[model samples]
Target: MAPKAWTTKEVEAALRGQCEGRHRVAPGLYLRIEAPKPGEGGRASWSFRYQINGRSRIMGLGAVGDVTLAAARRKAEEALLLVRGGADPLTLREQRAREAAAAALAARMPSFREAAQQHIESQQAGWRNEKHAAQWAATLETYAYPHFGDVPVDRIDTDHVRAALNPIWTTKPETASRVRGRIEAVLDSAKVRGWRSGENPARWKGHLALLLPKKAKVQAVEHHAALDWRDLPAFWGALAARGGAAALALRFAILTAARSGEVLGATWAEIDTVQRLWTIPAARMKAGREHRVPLSDAALAVLAEARAAGDGEGDARVFAGRGSGGGLSSMAITMMLRKMKRPGTKKPWTDAAGETVTAHGFRSTFRDWAGEATHHPREVIEQALAHGLKDKAEAAYARGDLLTKRATLMAEWATYCTRPAGAVLPMHKAAAQ
Candidate 1:
């Protein structure tokens, strides 16, 4: 009825019993029948045959040694299903293959840049400084963003990351390394989340180690500016002219060797006027331990003035603003300096190193003065500054606030900071006795 289907029995006899030449009969009629090469190892393999729009179509199956004779027959029969459906099995397979390839490529996958944003979001809480968090994100955004930003996480390789970093790696090694590590961290996160799967092309120890030079080999870089010691008098005088809470806060930062945020965030509750002490909470301390600042008479004087200006309300901040509307931000003190460059102002404060000093640099001045001019113990000076104790015993058992000692040290420090007495006077005769 259907042109009498071809029989495998007759085909076998045709190839094996009839021709008796070198040609090997592969499965499917008029399919691929190749002369076995010596290196082919006498293994039989499957081949396919079908028809499409009255034309012969053929396809290759895997080695017959890998697939049995019965298996090859079954494959050929399945291939025929496509032929019966008015589709060329070979052409259909190719079209389907291309469609699958296109579908895979079109799949939505996270890029390296997106992975970095996710990583930052997941870990923002642990960072100490909010500015540090900004720096962390911004560095990647600026440097690595253009190179690897659009690259799919799975497609990222060692060279792509290295390419982004190599431009700055030699000259600005520290920053470059940080950028590299951040990229690695994001990729690692991707791997853990199953977004990517591969050997980490970014790992520093076993892989990138072989390519890039060690970062630690390079010398550390310095900041843009520093102050000279000889110019303190004029700078101190200029500071005196700003003359308000901002000026006071700057002076306090200098006087205590504390950071700007610490001084601005101060509240009245922290000060015990009767006891002449300021107990900074552990959360506020850079060292994450409580620090008691001993108040000098001058410091107490400043506090009293601040308190008088504040509402008699006990909870009032010694330095309050209208709730983030106009408090002393980090820019506040820096802006005050820039204003000093205004016409009719005398510029002061050049460092021994011959650069303009910054708001934070005053701490260095105070530390230098403490070392050169005062007799306070190094640990006591450090304790007064609320620097965490390096000494094990002091760190463990010295729980009691050493406010009295700090008060005395700060008073002595304040004496050095303020104008010297008009003239040194002799002690009275009774005091001499």
Candidate 2:
């Protein structure tokens, strides 16, 4: 005869009674009750006992409080069916549990934007400064985010990457290139965390390169617009006539032949009035190396003027913005140049090619003058501009910065900038002097 099944009332009695032993509820289901231990309450739960290959096995259904007698019977009946089918019910349950866990993990995978943000946070410590981090975030937000930022990183494909880059590829080739690289980096990071698989869709060399035109092919290399070296003297005269922090900053930048970022970010602490030097920290320089700039008399005068205006002191910005005590806006010098008239004419000062002169272009102007009109060595000129050597052999041996030689070059440049426009010097004559 088949074993008797449990009733609801009998199951409730088993939970409340003082009995402490296993009681059969069905052919394979049983209610287990344990005696109360030291401070713990008595325990009652359901277990399904079955036979497989003439061997007994047990599976936990649930607690009596959670699984009712009727539910326990149904679960046991299912396990018995599986046992008769030559399958181990416990093994199947464990497999189901593992599958559920994997599903849960897949659901928690990050979106493209989330992955990008995580990657940026993880890499911030190695970047040069906060501005680099900010730039990374800004580009992704403006370019990458709108296309597929909310999509799961694992689902991102080449189509999404192409969508983000195609619009800017030819028009803003440089920015598009950066955006593509950033997307590749974010996707690579996602893959590393096992959130995604497959090759990176944003990769350029063998992948996107096949789809899009090369950056150089689509866009001509554009050099910064620079004033002709011959026009610099008259331009300097006009600049000296103006009296403002922006004008002073521009004058100082031109004198030092420094990049606009370096000039605008300069603090009084970086300037040594006695040594006539401006030392830019490695963090601020583009090459990630410390650079020493030899300051000329003209550059020193600009600093003095800034000092008189209450901007020069320890750690204070040499060209401070109004009311913020921070460095002047990056566009301050450019805007100053924009408003200046060409000598006596109403037109703005522009390069010979008719492009508006940019603050960075002054470096090119300085380089041209040094190469064509002065006798300074190429290494000294490059050192003054804080440029990295391209020749590996020369760079390996060129350990010194050529500071003394750079000082002489800068002083000559300053004198040339301040001299009369008509006083043109022959190259040989200037070299002899």
Candidate 3:
């Protein structure tokens, strides 16, 4: 039987017995079982001997334990198949290994700017709006790209991150904070995609927090100068006197007590004239929740005027800009405020601080009025503002929008705004003072 031609059972027995020399398992596959001589352990390894173009070569088929008896034979057969096809198996394996190494090196070579762009491209669709996408690109272009645009993502360190943040850390703390967060996001994406490996250099809580002063410590709380609740009647009167799309939009914003961005981004499709409701989508609202604002009679009239001003063109934007695309520029209302003179003076409509009142300030004014003047529940007032509840339990249970109560409240608010200056009486003792 020619010694049974070296079966798997024979090979295992020989390896355990510490066979001294190589023994053939197949035509070209051989197993070498080593004796525990000197510091060496009892082990066995398989090898494939092949002749390519009359040149003999030996290729390792891994260790006996790592490669089973059946696996070793399979590898030996594959090697022989390659030799028959006029190709060297050893050279092909080396080539594949080299290609893998090249791919790994290439992945690590992308610059910080390149990686940031890729990350933005991958994530922009999921972002709530285009303005956020623009902000992501703008911050990297203005701050990070200037410092380390061409530097490889894997090589970014504490120094690189600090360099980008240091200049604006104190001077422009708000912008700098956003830039730091964005850089961290891009670097995190790089690490997750296997383009880089290391702790994020721009991390905030434990890492960059050590390098920079707390944002609250270095940055002053600059409130947008709000038109006083007392002055709203007069302000509304003056705003009504003006005639333009921006003025109408500003009036609607005040009547609705909505954010400037929300008011500006309003589209015709979002409003239901029959329901007297302006439903801002979750994507447009900062709270990431849909908010239905009860449209007051004054608010509806403002929309009518806006439609007439645009010659009833049927544009999608409620307050369309000068051009064919996009809604009103956020600054348009601010610019109108800048140009408007106070009731009898050459001075602009300034807040108590003597600074120009911003479009956003109306929301603050609304909050103060709703809190002090109205008998509405605190939750209803907060709901009208589209504010998230600070109390977890309250937020969990308070799901109803209280839309009917809100409608009554908003109507009373609009009526109060349209009242003559003399008809507006003080709601609290301090106001009378």
Identify the leading candidate in terms of lDDT.
2
Of 1 and 2, which scores higher on TM-score?
A: 2
Model 1 lDDT per residue over 1-433, tens place: 2234345665455445333332323335232334556777233345676667778766876763466556666777778776777777787778999999756744768778877887898888887657667988999998888887898888998879888888887889889888888888888898987788988887899888888889877647655344443345456666766665667777766666676777787787788878877777876777777777777776777776666656523555565553432345667677676566422556544456655567877776777766666666666667766776787876797675555666666776676666542323222111110
**How does candidate 2 score on lDDT?**
0.89
Residue 287 lDDT (model 3): 83
Cα distance off (Å), candidate 2, residue 66: 29
TM-score for each predicted model, relative to the true structure? 0.60, 0.71, 0.71
Which is the better candidate, 1 or 3, if ranked by lDDT?
3
Candidate 2 least-lDDT 10 residues: 424-433
Stretches off by above 4 angstroms in model 1 are: 1-107, 125-132, 170-174, 198-216, 219-234, 267-292, 307-326, 341-345, 383-404, 421-433
Error of 1 at 21 (Å): 91
Output the TM-score of candidate 3.
0.71
Please write out the lDDT profile of model 3 over residues 37-123, one tens digit for every residue. 678788789999888888889889899889988889888888889888999999999999999976875755789998898899999
lDDT of 2 by residue, 1-433 (tens): 8777778888888778857899998989999999999999988999999878888888999987788888999999999899888999998999999999767756798789888998999999999889999999999999999999999989999999999999999999989999999999999999999988889999998999999999998885768999999999999989999987788888989999999899888999999989888999999998989999998888898898888886568889998876667888878787888899987688988998888899989999999999999878888899999998999999999999988888888989999999988797665322332
lDDT of 2 at 279: 95
RMSD of 2: 15.1
Question: In angstroms, how far off is 180's CA in candidate 1?
Answer: 3.4
